[model samples]
Target: MNTQALGVEYYLAGMRAALDDLPPNEVAEIMEDVEAHVAELSTELGENETLEQRLGSPEQYAQELRQAAGYPPRTERLPVTTKKQLVTRPRVAAWGLAIATAVTLLAGTAVLRQSAILLLPAVLLVLSLALVHDRGPAQQEIMDLPETRKIQQWLTPEEGTPGERALTYLKSLQPAWWLARAGLLGLGAVLLASRDILGFLFIAGIAVLSVFAGPRAKVDRRWLWFSLPASALAIGLLFQVIDVTANNLAYSSSRQVYQPPAMQSYENIYAYDENGKLLTNVLLYDQDGNPINAPRQYYGCNGDDPQPMIPANRYPRPKIDYENGSCYTVAPSVVAPSSTESAPPSSSGSAPSNSVAPTSVSPSK
Candidate 1:
């Protein structure tokens, strides 16, 4: 190739690399337009005038095209020597702080559950936000970062590679993930609020905001301020829910025997007859002929002198104030018992006339 042709080819190669992030078809069309333009310019160039003198560097040319086409400005890859210098840039530092804050907040709140450790991330987040606001226009600087490019290259690997396939699969699931994130956020809110309606609504609003902001944040960095914190809180709440569920399951499994629902709260059983008279020494049984048991081993007292009552189906047990050395009988109403009679044994399977049924009373009541 002649000198002019070689210059054109070299320019196009540089422009191609600059626009690597664009779609292949779009890149091809852009290259064709630039090639035709450069050919015309090469013909008009004097002997000593180069394409770089006429059109500036290929990176600069590509940037002009991007601006004209209403595309975001591309970040040209910098050499390894300049990477350290770029890391100290305010925009790059802000992004680094933002990432560190997110990771620390998530780990501290959800995994570590340590409030003392969370102060650092909180301060970092505030500093990150301040830097982002002050630095202005961080998207280009962030994209130009060495770490960012490495991540992009890793995610967008060579075709047919396992990384590429995995990336493709993950990209396909993006819509589903977006929906799941909102749902999970709402669920976490509900769990954290103990199923309160107001809490659900508040988190649900944040979830909705996140769903919309998540996509926009890719193009617009400002949305990060809202989206990041909301996501962190959602993830923390989800972990909290998981921890609570696991604890409940462990507690339930530790108990060898199941306690009946009716006996869960009440410790003593009381029996009453049809005439509103209290019945004493009444034995109770279930339909299956099983003795209905009470919850506690001792009853009828409140202190160290608690009366040891045998575990039986007896009802209308006396209430005793051990401190006062007094035992008192309880009735359903002001009416006294007709007599101190031992009622006949009763079964839940069949109700007999004058058969007194055992009733449970909670300790608080």
Candidate 2:
């Protein structure tokens, strides 16, 4: 960890411990200001003056914070909550968490292609359990405050609730919470090294803003202004990449007609089948003056070694010859002004020795 990161972690831990009796919302707010203050101080302090040298011990700094925030000194007794916190908060938090967990798990597994969504609920569950055991503010005036009553209630153990048993389990595993958070940071760092560092940093920043901004507290509009649009843009880019990749795969799978290079005037075309019976419907002008019927692709040949010949361009037109003797001559009158005429056949289905089919017309036609 960087010195700055370590200092922030230690200072925040002490602050949380010091403000244990306060409402979670208040603690969150105070910590936000503390973080901002520590960040500011870090920029100004000399190398000789560490955070401890400047701010003293975390417990002492926390006491100063409580006094500044108009709170009494820490006491051995448990904290108290208002009627609103007691009645409405727990149920609302429980339902909120339940719904959030279900949606996160489903969306992460189904849409985002990330399994890390499962870790989210586990972390939330740990925090929820820890909240159950922590004491709330005991001051009646503080509890009665309108602002405090309006905020969401923190989770705590209640009669007939599973949190009662869970609290003990959570308390036994407080050290694990630290480990989990550290692991999260380590994972984020690894992802930065191996994956998208900008994305990781952006997400980490958004998460920090969301936590410290508090549901009802006013911190900075800038964090909101930046995070929301940036997140939307990131999602948009992800969709675009997915769409482009799909298109590339679809295009790759579909057959492509080979286009010979423009630099080469003559293109060699060949076809072969191991069974040697590749038949194809061919459009040819018959011996009469009439054109053949509409020539869709058809199986026309039936034998092996259908030797192909291409007439050289020395002739007035290009033509093709099939040694199999399937192609027959078209009368000179029947051949279109544009169509190349096939050479006349001789005795026993053989083409005239001197008559040659032009090369270009056969495959193209």
Candidate 3:
């Protein structure tokens, strides 16, 4: 290769490594621009003049490019001692709290039925906020540390790997997740508020705040204190709703399986004769020749003194208070009998006088 060609290749190689942390498309564009600029400069170079003399080192050129592009300055790799000092105790504690918060939040979701589990994540989140506050301006330095940069790089997805693809997919879903988080927070507010209108409005306002905070937190790390806890609470509420819904469905299924259709909501049966006089001890039977007894075990006046009645095929049963040894008839409503009601002749060919029989019955609770 010619001297100029070798110089260009060496410069390009160093530039590529220096800009490795940038997006691939951005790096490619930068390289193209630099290559063209170098070619133009080479034609104007005098004898004994080198590319390094005109453009400085490749790292310096890359730095100027980053500044022109409005990208943050590239962080250089730190020596072992500097790296150790950069990983301050406060930063380490803050990261630990963050991890603990995530773990507890996930565990809380798994055991949403046990609401107490939510407390741990909440406590961890508080600790994280406190640590961030204590770190103050130094927090920025901690974030810029080599270890932190390495973690960020690892988290950023690259092409052609399953884990990377998964991470990319998750990142793509962030906007949708933000909206869902708001909805979850609103739903949780409704549940916690129950019937209190003012309380629901107050909590719903927080959910609305989350809607704005969620997107803002992505661009500004300072918003994380509010966004992180809000998101965790929203997740907890979502899982709690799921847990409650599941339990209710299970209970409803069991009730449907075990309870007889006719006996549901049944409390008492009232019988009346044609003259509107309440009937007593009126026997009841089904078309299949089976006796229809009361479904529940106990009946009483106003449910004050409940006492079991002997299971039998009888309507208009009396309420017995065993404690006071008293019996009273349950008269829910009165109905007038038809004026044309008449008795049929007896077996002896004589009509009975003033004889009545229950003609209809109704159940009530």
Candidate 4:
């Protein structure tokens, strides 16, 4: 019990320490004794005076009780530091704490933007801290310091701290910050080869923007202008890469002869269906022993052009019919020739009425 200074805080602290070991019954007895003392004092003062005034002061009363109990006076004990004092904030301290807490909350929210689970505690903590820090110190002694000559200035009609002003400034830039974040995400997806790296960059961008939403961060970067558009452009270029790779693979597999391709005409063109794109020009070949030419594409065939041309380019002589109705190409086997030898003499027989196979040749008698 080192109560070097006797103050209100020390007086209560001493009592609390004594009560820690004392039973509930003992505490009740102490209370009753104090009440009895006050009552007696009240009676002596002739009911006109309050019991409080007759008792001198609460501290003095407690001191006398200590003497009567064979305990040292509360003033002779050391000061008892409390959790209350530790947590309590001075005016300036409160403002600084508020700014730091606000910044922390914003930073946390930004970091956890993708995860709702993480953002809640950070937000709750910020609000709680702000509520507490916004209040001035519990006790203030007024002095005639020139308001204008004060070391610090506030940004409002009412009074505030530089941190509050900073917070307000930060709040104003949130929209831009968010835009930048989305832009940076795109940029990262472009620049980062690994998926994990890209994901981290995306989260970082979100955090940066989220912090900007609070009243604590400063933003004055020039290169910030290109962040979003450049990211989008990069993403678009990736689409092109996918497209080229897909086309290359498609071309390699196009050699399968079993699956027929979309119909084409004289000048080569790609064909399409209602649903989507189709494989085109699978049986590529040309007449007169030449490489196939690009064929024209048509979705529908007119009455004059009923049967669409399917090139049967397997045989020799490479005959390709351009007739309107004949869906024609050369057969796969032998080639026909322009020149022919003379036919040998033959005997003719009359056709039978019901004989399915009646054609016969006999030597003339």
Candidate 5:
């Protein structure tokens, strides 16, 4: 139940019970006073008995009146739509400037400050933008017009209005407004139930405002119930920043791409293979053979295959034939020793021979 109806119930029931303790005459006076006030409201609201029947019990009716007589402010308890539009110009400017500033700060420092602790600014900005109110006319401007007067008159029909019946329809909607608000609160609760702690806190705060804001506003219009869902929007936007940031952090830290040794070979590949062609390319994959699509370094493989080193070391190194001191690429007629010294010539006047297992060789480029 909305605070309006709920409060109304307690008011009337309490008043009624309290009256029971008074002298019979005083009890009669209380009933008469209540009846008089209701009659007054009925007259103002287009006195239609049918519309009044839609309003719940007498206790509920009396409670609504009691609330309008200056109940506690219900900032934390208004329905979503009935929420006061705190989004005014300076506040809007303030929020806009604040957002722009934050974007700049985050962009500049996100790289320099890796601490997830930047959440402090994010949360502070949210609360500041929400709670600040240094803008707008000090109070909402009440409209002044002949039509407004007409509307009020029609709503609160005089003892003699020609369309009492039409006004009655408007009057009948009052109770429905309360029920609609209650439904809104129910729906909000259903949604909040599935959310996290922050979400629940946001929803519950606004829902409480929903139940009481309308009554506190002393709104005479019956359609105010339509504005309640806006509370959910406000609360959702308020909490989404935190939720989104956390989600992004989780995503960024997972893993890097896969580069392979074959890719590394792409960089320093400089040799001819047995086929007399350059072996500039090599393919690498996991046991599953699914290609790893990253730079070779990413896979911790810079083309450092043991097979390639074996060929480069054992084979004669390329040398520039020193004819006229001109450089020419050719296999060395003699192999150089690793210690930068010439190896002793073989007795048969040929390069030393070796017995090794056969292996596949691709030409270098």
Candidate 6:
């Protein structure tokens, strides 16, 4: 073999590695065409382009090949497909993009509802995804292509344990699952940032690890166990943080007034002036100081002389008849009465007292 053939052989090897995630037979089928293409390219060396220049890197070329074969981009290598477990699967990237667009639109609408203009981007993303995976009669449909089914049949396993079955199911929907996972992670990051930057960064780091783990999950699905829990934890913490932050914000924005003791009833209570002094013989007046003789409907209580109702548990309770003016007290003056109005002063120089015999007050139930 000459130098050109050796180079072609190396190139083919790289291509094979790039496609290693796929089933062996599929890779072999692809290489046959690649070998022919390389041979043809070698003869056209004088056409102002080297093979590498014309075709680009092997990994990139492999991505193009995968897409051309009606598969998703080679972002990660999945478990190898086989002959026995035949199945059909959708193009992973298309469905992934479709689901991601939907999730982003929902999240964006929730976070950015105040800015109607921002909704345009989300709408456009949804429409584009719809167009890409569209199965309607109006446009060219790629999802139902025969090659997609053949590839799925090659990937599925015939018999498996519960874990293996679950893994197989996941592998079928892997692309969309990852995208949905990423979308949830992004929402978590946003929520975390709303409360704490450090928390958001921590969750972001975990998310990065989970993303990298996607490719290797085909080898050992232990990564899924770790990643799923980590994701759940991050999301839970983020939601908690956001909830606390929202509550705090709401509390801070309002005025904090002191609450009185629970038993201090204000029902049927007397009103007082700001200085804690009682208003006596009070008369109703409007802002213009005009006498307002409104009907009882305007004011729930009647008299200018207001009296407080006795506590519900008080013994010998006041007969408070609502229809008539009972259990009411009216004070003639705000100050103590003059000495001249009272009975003749006691023989002693001291003022007389109006005390009555002590009576026991019963405790409230």
- Model 1: per-residue lDDT, tens digit, 1-365? 23355487678767877886665457656765676789899899898888988898888888888898987777545534543464454455557566754775475245333333444555666666665453333343455456766777777899999988998999888667667778777675555465355645566676788798778776566566666665676667667777888999988887646653443354445565765455678887899998886554333334464544544577644433323433333332223434436442233211211322222233331
lDDT sort, best first:
3, 1, 6, 2, 5, 4
Q: What is candidate 3's lDDT per residue for 125-230, written digit by digit as tens?
A: 6766665554332244345546776887899757789989999889899888889988987876666565655546655875899889877866555467667766
Residue lDDT tens for model 5, 42-123: 5554333432354555545545644664433223333343224565333443444345345434432331123233344445
What overall lDDT goes with each candidate model? Answer: 0.60, 0.44, 0.61, 0.38, 0.39, 0.47
Top candidate (lDDT): 3
Candidate achieving the largest TM-score? 1
Give model 3's clash tally: 0
Candidate 4 or 5, higher TM-score?
Answer: 4
lDDT string, candidate 2, 78-164, tens digits: 434432255444443344344445544343222223424434544554454343322222222233344444542433556557876
TM-score of each: 0.46, 0.29, 0.45, 0.23, 0.22, 0.27
What lDDT would candidate 4 get against the real structure? 0.38
TM-score of 4: 0.23
lDDT of 4 by residue, 216-320 (tens): 222221112122222332344345445556988887788564566544322322233333323334454556666554323222223444233445321122223
Q: Which stretches of candidate 4 lie over 4 Å from their true place?
A: 1-55, 65-97, 113-302, 311-365
Cα displacement (Å) at residue 357, model 3: 20
Cα deviation of 156, candidate 2, in Å: 37
Number of the candidate with higher lDDT, 1 or 3: 3
lDDT of 1: 0.60
